[model samples]
Target: MSSANLDQLHRSTLGVYESLLDQFNPGLQRLVALGKTYIQAFQALSSTSEEYFHALGRMGEQALHTLSSRSLGDVIIQIAESQRRLTNELDGMFRWFHSEVLREMENNVKLDKDFIAGSRRRYEMEVHNHASALDRQQRRGHQDVVEYTHFLRDSQKDALKEEERRYRFLAEKHCNLSLTIAQLMNKMGGALHQRAEEWGDCVNETRASRPRTPSRMEQMGMREEERAQQWTKREEPSLGRVPSRGPSPVLMRSRSGSLGDGLGGGRLMRAIVSCAPSPNPTLLDFSMGDAITVLVPEPRNGWLYGKGQNSPRQGWFPASYVEPLDQAPRPPLPRGTNPFATVKLKPTVTNDRSGPRAPGRII
Candidate 1:
């Protein structure tokens, strides 16, 4: 073929491809928009469901309150109101579901029809253009025609593949919608069950003249006691101490003592350092499990001023780092001994080579 004819053929083919793309692009965009709309609709449905459930809960509370008033007429009215509200909610949900389904179906049908028509029109235009170009270039051999035919086939195949992909996407979206509907139904079923139970309880309460069984608070307290007993049984071996049924003697005694006098001489409170304090100029550095005396019960700006039991160091530390021990039980002291008294050191007798040394060096 002549160079001019070849160039003309190339431009015509390019135009046909550009035209196909332009036609397909809008269809693809519409499909994406449809998918997004479905997602948004589902989200709105979920939010509506939540609001409905919340309203139902409020109605249940009102019913309970009416029942508590011990007026059978009021309870009956409340139950009737609840049933009416439930019926309305169910009707609204059904209407919404039907409308959304119909709308989605209509949109899908329209998109499919538009896509099919556009594809058919583009295919015809492409074939006509290729035929005209081949006729103008009659001098070209059979091989050239074969190659051009192959290109057209490949383009047609690509368009078919894109259509299939869109159909698959739509199918998946339909499946998702079905799943969401099923989930909403399940939630509604559960809510219905709960409402029925509440109604049954209210009816029973009205019919029975017997004293009320244990309230929820009493039941919870009993459960807590059982759990505590189980926990103490499991922990006693590890703790190496028997679990007391009531408050320990130590705790009772500690509660009886004044806060300041509980520690020693009404000046300090003994505690064990449970954690190491961060390095600070004003804070004392102590290891974990070290004993200390709290000089101040309350912290000043998140720091506690305390003195270490083993060391003479007195400084501030984080209040969280210590466990108070002033309330713990201790052995009784001797009759004449003061608990906080300083010990007096006795003089040491040393034997020299010549004679016994004077008792002057007191340790």
Candidate 2:
């Protein structure tokens, strides 16, 4: 072919390759965009979790300011709505990515199995050539060997090593690629199956178009019957059941006034509980695990004293000696000072024993 014609043919081939690559580029871009969206959504979810906790803290602050009981419900509803929105956003993002990116990537990305086989065959041929060269070197005549023995042996060894290395490297790469593609396919297939199952139950009823109904006597009677059945199950005694006479004769209590029912105080061990000012506080720093020296809040004879807390030890030190590290949080102001400090806290009252309500929630 003429040089001009050859150059033109080369350009045309390059264009064709580029066009083939371009066919998958849009899908690849969409996959990238989906990943970015998930990351952004995840970040937003993290921020939302922090804010939700902050809102709960604010509810604690507003506990004393109740105009009516309904206000608490409103606050709870708001918290629920925020959580629901975050969950829905995550669900939508997952669905979109699964359908548009992962599924397409698995189902449509054609694997060239023949190329892998071809590479393996070529690698084997190369290795066979190296073995044959080594054999030929070993059989060479002594007269020729005297002049070129070292060079021939070295050349044969180097060539064999290079061939073996290339073979191993190619084989490993192919295996890894195959495993990755298989894992991706499995994950995509599993997710698709799970989603299909969930969608089956949803029954295609959109929120905007679903019908609402109020039932009469039959519904109420059915609910009452269900409740009665549930109640009866608790009331009924099992045939093999052994009834306890009364409260245990043995008293089981820890030195810390805790009921040691397998719920040991291991968490308390090596833990320095600090009374820090609220707005924001670093809860735990894994990086500073043992290095963290904190000032724990103690109700010292009802005066509230915070000193350096060596949690592993039984007692605390003087507040003066225990310096509040810059990283350590300041003590939370007394609930008396902050009216909103204890608002909207879940009523931590247990029905096991009846008593007057206690002050502030413990961690």
Candidate 3:
């Protein structure tokens, strides 16, 4: 082919490359813009969720202020704490997506586009310069000048071929970001799912720890029935039933030396024998396995008062130190030396005895 014909063919091919670049440029730009829009929407959703959790935390703070003493307020506080953690993790994930994934996609796309476009432009410039030099050399009408221009044109053609090869390679590599971006998205999505699941599990654990309210009439009725049975059993435990937690207020007012049969303390019972030495004066001191009398079967603030079996060592002691005896204790033998030798005289002083108590530390 003639040089003129070759130049015309090269120019025509350059025009085709320009058309393809112009068409593909918009598509690549549109893809980037669309991706940005998608990421922005995702970011907005995350921001909205973070704000929602913050609102919940504020609401929980209000609940705590209004109902500090209530159990419901405590549960609300726990929920708020959990939601705050979720929001923090969500924010971190979004930051990584924005800084790492989105930035990488944008940079790669721009770099690839620039490389392809630059190579095409460079090749076109070299071709144009070569053709101009040939026309100038031919116009000089010098054989030597024409020969030198041909040499220069051959070098330029070699350079153009390399540029063309690079341009084709770059264009072929265009938009290969799909698999890379998809892989990054998959990794980020998995991390997001894991964080969300952890938050859900934490919320579930908080709910599980909360106390359930009585929701049924049957449950209320059952509670009342259990209470009645407890009182009846404490009054007469020989029937073998559940015991009352404490004495009733009305029955606790008995001024008599001995309480009424309704309370479990009226009878004399054998001592539990095991007693620890106490620092307080009101607390009874006794050796291990020593005999004593008990005034109460159950604990009242963890204390019970009674007189010693053979000695005048009547005072208060921990309820844990004694239990009700199945059999009545053997009365001390009426003697001349002992002050509380008579069994009948013992209840007179010990039964009305409600004054002595160990401090809060004793319990």
Q: Judged by lDDT, which candidate is best?
A: 1
Q: By the lDDT metric, which is better: model 1 or model 3?
A: 1
Per-residue CA lDDT of candidate 2, range 1-363, in tens?
343543354344344334334444344446546766765777687677767766764674465265432334344444545454545555555555556545544443333123334434554464455545656876783222232334333434543454455346435644654565566557555665665555444433332345435367656665656665564456433333112221121222445766433234212222223333333222222211222232222323222111122333222222222222434643443322433334587768656545555688443
Instruction: Encode model 1's per-residue lDDT on 60-107: one tens digit a residue.
Output: 666656545444445555555555555555556545544564456456
lDDT values, one for every candidate: 0.57, 0.42, 0.56
Every model: Cα RMSD to truth:
22.6, 30.0, 20.9
Candidate 3 least-lDDT 10 residues:
237-246
Regions more than 4 Å wrong, model 1: 1-79, 91-101, 131-140, 145-150, 165-176, 179-183, 204-363
Provide the clash count, candidate 3: 0
Candidates ranked by TM-score: 3, 1, 2
User: For every model in order, what is the number of clashing pairs?
Assistant: 0, 7, 0
Q: Which stretches of candidate 2 lie over 4 Å from their true place?
A: 1-10, 18-65, 72-76, 106-363
Q: Please, what are the lDDT tens digits per residue for candidate 3 over residues 103-222?
A: 654675577567657767776676576666667766887323354345445645654564465446445444344454565557656765776576567557656876456568757665
